[model samples]
Target chain A: MKEEIQDNLIQIHDLRISIYSEGSYFDVVKGLSLSVCSNEILCLVGESGCGKSITALSVMGLLPTDVAQVTNGEILFRGQDLLKLSASDMRRLRSDEISMIFQDPITSLDPVFTIGSLLTEIIRVHRNVGSSEAENMAVDALEAAQLPNARQRLKSYPHELSGGMRQRVMIALATALNPAVLIADEPTTALDVTVQAQILERLRERQREQKMGMLLITHDLAVVAEVADRVAVMYAGEIVEEASVQTLFDKPQHPYTQGLLGAIPDITARRGSLHAIPGRVPPPQVPPPGCEFAPRCVHALEECWESRPLLEGSGEGKLRCFNPQPLIT
Target chain B: MLIVLLISSVAVFYAIRLSGGDATAAALPGSATEEFREEFRARIGLDKPIYLQYFAYMGKILKGDPGHSITNNASLVEMLKEHGKNSLVLGGAAFALVFLIGVPLGVLASLRRNSWADHGIMSFSIAGMAIPNFWLALLAIWLFASTFRILPAAGCCSGKQLILPAIVLAFEGIALTVRMTRSAMIENQNNDFVRTLRAGGLSEWRVMGKHVLRNAMIPIISLAGLRIGQIVGYALIVEQIFSWPGIGQALVTAVLRRDYPVAQFFSLVLVVLVVLGNWLADTGYTLANPRLRRSR
Candidate 1:
């Protein structure tokens, strides 16, 4: 077992996951490698069902039973292989060492529980604290997440709060123990434009204060542009490209990445038609073997349809393509 | 306060109308003279205006003496109290039986949606829905009382006897509850929050228990509330059929003899039970939904 034992907070090697459907197993995430350093944000950008959220869920060991299964892979956290850990041990590690905030806050929280109960449950489970003290800490965490009226709001139920407030409460619950890593899976997908911005901003603020590593899975490129330090472009359950955000945006090497960038509508651009990807993201059940995006690639070559490209580093960026898109002059 | 009073007065008016004003005030076909009828009307305070009579009845009811039965001389309040207890016991037991069996089965079927387990449970639910209550009650009596002779067939007593009637009473409720729970569970399974909880590192049990069950229960609570009155009403029929000396059997006796006061009192008790059931359901719903509290 090769263990990269430096400052890496999380490291995954040769992780392979398959889903059971219709009496057959289909590979959802092929052999994939990823690393997240402490106090950094890694963004996974892709269209829907690209295995980005699946990868994040795998790291938390939260894959649903009867469908998704981690067949092969080793998720190492703090020099310990997560898959090998006992369920009892992993339960302790989940909310304390690595926490997660979901996409929709409205439904994520229990309707019967007050915000105070929800927040305090996490605190009491992970921390050896009394209820009164835990409640005070929960309120502080909520305030840290920038929720107004933290004291009064704690008494309110999740439905009593606005969408934005509920999201903040979720953040507060996830961060009450100051976990080392936070996985936010499409955290702003359900919110309005303005609320989305506020939630992202709150997440970034909390990440910086806690100096916690974050694996943010999202389909929205704008969100990634605003928050990511490194961006991994996923296409049909594979990371086609990985590079620093500035490098990926400044000089996109993958045709899929370029297509995504092109698809982003700019409000300031004048007299220009909005660009769209030619077709929808292909369903994962029968993903094309050779380059999944070859069918949609404007710059596709014959080799792209015959041979799949392994992720190879060329200069400052890595891309999995036979012929990476050339830099625009 | 005004609404409650207005509603009470309306109920009273309807009750009086249904009983044909006052039987004693009208002259008897063969025995009573006009002078005797007029004197009896004055004695009973029926000679006064309807509105004044209403106030006097309301006063007596509030003071806990709901007047005496015209035929039996039994106090309406006492009769209601005795019969209401039996009804409550039967209804409560039936409810317990229905929910205890229904909820878990519904949840299991939902979790294993489209599986054989789901199909079997649904078939049972359908059977429960199709079977009529009276027939089921009679069947219970025949099987337990007449055929095997293990139970007495009717009356609120310990043994195999209560089982059949309770089961018969609960069968439809269980069916309703199971269908509701299964559908609610199915709906909750697809909720984004449930997905989110699963993604948030919760195990399947935790997700279902904490998120799915709680949310799914909201609708079930409302359904239970609406069904409570019906269940109690059904208890009356079941009790009469089974010779269970409960409210319904007593009601039949009172109604058959045209004991107007006793009948009216029993009806009022039922209405009160229904209203109270509704109130409890509302409170339960509010407790389950945070959005409701915030809106209020």
Candidate 2:
């Protein structure tokens, strides 16, 4: 267990984020804890507005200051607390130690810059390298991302490339510096199914090549099944379950995780309809007094409505529920 | 573009002609006999049908001859060349002042957004835009010329004298440019790419100065070109206040003196300048935006 904790490249502890809107602040991410271990991909599975993107931004120190604030908790990168770093220190650590790729590839790159300049600039910023050396490194990164005509693509602007190609460029850019940790927020959500597979393959290949820890955020369960080594299910800003991907998919304990697994449309089943969790995730501004998923759970007991459940468990797994669904055979 | 010029020339010719004063009557004195007036009208070809008169005027213009001023008999082309240079100098100085001051001030305001400096700069710009140039000109002359004894009260052709009127002309332009730069920078700063740049470990200066400013320059360059045309329009009043010898002052004089050829020539020049300004802006827009460049 101690060795496992030491292997984590990025560990987030009880992170709470608040967004100021209209007149007051609301907790968007309540005391959420997760980690990304070296050579493993931890898929943060959640629906939109469940604070997945916010969590990623906080780790990168890219959250907009006027709107969102990290009210509590620490994000530790390799045993150093990132939240305590100064602005310049955080900037220095970013792209050099940790990097990120965003969801929409269309708007992720600067339209006015050529692909060559964009890649070269990031390379030069993080490493003490000249332009020619940086250019070579950029070409290598592009090739690593499996981009075709990598050398010729240097002069092309973002608009000149197709969506898939741009996303490839984004992946190349994020991995260019060979950071220890990579945070990808729905990286394949904007691509077609074929392109999505290719991009995910590239990401997994990059992780294996570098032994980098990756926090892959996605709402698609199929994607979770494909690339995740471990899975953390989030509902309304809190983790409901954490386990090995096989365990989570085969025997989802938390009611929310079960509902998520059941909601995935199965091609082999001759069914009446797909299963959907009954109620929506409650808004953070006015959350109910108990477990956030209790109102939507089929196994909610009388005690589930009284108070929130602590995340408690033994080795390799954790569960936060008053009454969890029974294990499947 | 040629079609627009042709249409504007026709409008200028007819509008000046229909402005309720006979060219022959304005040229000849009341003591002159009807025979003298008739001879003058025939000499200038005004006795012909109105359409023929218009055609004659156009032919002369196409031949690079705008006829002569009715009051002084000076060549209209020579007058335009002399006065056009002064207008160019004044307008150029005013334009330079507008951008050099406005852009940096805008950047500062945006960087310090919602601070006291931002509020102060914005409030000043609002007041600058609200004040009329004529009023501002008068106030400047009173303060700088009459009170301080620093500048000449009214005149032109000197660097020192250029200062007062140029500031008066550039006041509104500076205000407009500030608003434009600040808003454009703020808008681009909110774009998704900004976050990408930040997450890429770029320094705040490089991100804001290089990327954000480059995107912001698209609208700014367009505004700059349009402002050049507006400066010339505003020059008419500014020159009148300063008694500066420019094309605008020349146009006003020609109109009051009923110098038809000179008035028509100067008006056409102003129209051509405005059209040229818009063309420059379109070219600048294409240059600043890569997407537009690739589309073309």
Candidate 3:
């Protein structure tokens, strides 16, 4: 509701998304909140089960209707609550304004359709275009993604292409509409380090070309380092720290952030046992009552276990901690 | 492609000759003798050695001059040309029905897994698989003709009469397609692509249609192809029960009357249809499965 920027493309506020299954039970995504500004890459960094992907799916309105429920949330995209839109309207927004590229390339595409068929299907559906025109657009998209033999590759099936090539094709499909926002959920997780780099480069190039705002979700800190302009560190379905990529790397604030940075094997640091956060992340079903990361925080005070920490701050960074790290400014 | 067709044709010819030899050995009391064999051989260009006969038969067939039926004295090629269209129409219509109804129902069942709709489809599928085609045809006759007086029990020529027989034929096809489709869909529902499609802002129905449904239907298409031959086989029985004047009925009449040429020609026709069905299935498999093209 509080969209501060006049040029902001997406504004999400106190987005409390919870997936209820069976009887009125299990809230998978517990009161998560995040935002991505236009033309900026916001990396939603979290371990598995921290509701990173849930938040992304909520934005897309693609969650399974049966087991998943957005109990409460405000996913404001360009001053409209996407959750309240009609299914048709939501669909219109999905492939046009917001698109997503998933992690695994091998399984993301339909094995039965040629890349051309898949591309043309999407292109034709979203635009009033002829098959030939759509195909030409697809070829252009493929070339833009740095894929070789755009014409021949279009005729080929997903399996015929290499892992990197498949990912590139995925990028092409995602960006074909020149979507204003692209949500890439662990897009390079399934590839080799080299292929991952190539996929990332291709995606980055496409993103730059379209000047599209991107929400890059990944658990890999290295990946976050490689592409993220800003990073939001999620813990137990809550963002514990959010800051500029440079600020998060050079001056991590929250204790969890510090612990995460310390845990990274630093060749420059002495070869002692690497620092690690002691406990595992709490399960979503029965997350700790107070700050979700408190139990694992070495600096946990008496009150830390009794009250939840609100994500707060401005300018340089934000940290959700009872014992907040002072901002130098 | 032509070579494979030739080889398959030769294999079928040999199979028929072997079966025919067994019949000749028994030489049913009313049947003709060596005189008949000589006549049949000369008629079929089979007086020559097996290999030569194979080439001659194939060469003639290629030239659209397939030999005459030994029983009815009808041209084998001409008979197929006359009746093949009807069989194909029935087969194609049945296939369409199965796909149109079965696939969507299968997908719905998968989407609403464990729901009443799923339960209904699954139960129907089981019953369809369990009941024999002849029995199903009889039941269809009783239900549509005897009981409801809504449709003719047999002899479908007009598009209107096609409804009952087509539905009867499609019972098994639907069962096979639905069951396979449901199982395949359930399997594909677990695939990462479905998950990815969902993650990519695709609706459940769209994900099911574009990703899960197509992947699931791949196996079904092959099964359906194989079943088309089976349907052709079953068509004979159904045609007999319904008194429909299809190729199957003609073949049965030939067999009963000991019309050797007619029986031989019908058998060959069936074999060719089976082969063509298999070939069509292969091409379909190639087209449906991007994995094949992708692998290439």
Point to the candidate with the largest DockQ. 2
TM-score of the first chain of model 2: 0.97
Docking class of 1: acceptable
Give me candidate 1's interface root-mean-square deviation: 3.0
Query: Tens-digit lDDT track for model 1 on B23-42?
Result: 56332444778788888778
Per-residue lDDT of candidate 3, residues B1-296 (tens digit): 46765676666677656655433333234466778866755655657887787677667767977666554457776777656666766766776887787888788788789999999999999998899887888888888899999888777577867777777777877887787788898898877776555544456667787677778867877666677787788778866776666788778886766555556567767777777778778878867776664453
lDDT of 1 by residue, A244-286 (tens): 9999898998988988898788787886888888987766677
Number of the candidate with higher TM-score, 2 or 3: 2
lDDT of 2 by residue, A20-53 (tens): 9989899999999988889999999999999999
Model 3 residue A151 CA deviation (Å) reads 5.5
True A-B contacts kept by model 2? 0.79
Chain A TM-scores, per candidate, are: 0.95, 0.97, 0.94
Clashes of 3: 5
The Cα local distance difference test for each model comes to 0.81, 0.91, 0.78
Which candidate, 2 or 3, has the higher DockQ? 2
Which number leads on TM-score? 2
Using Cα atoms, each model's DockQ against the true complex is: 0.36, 0.79, 0.41
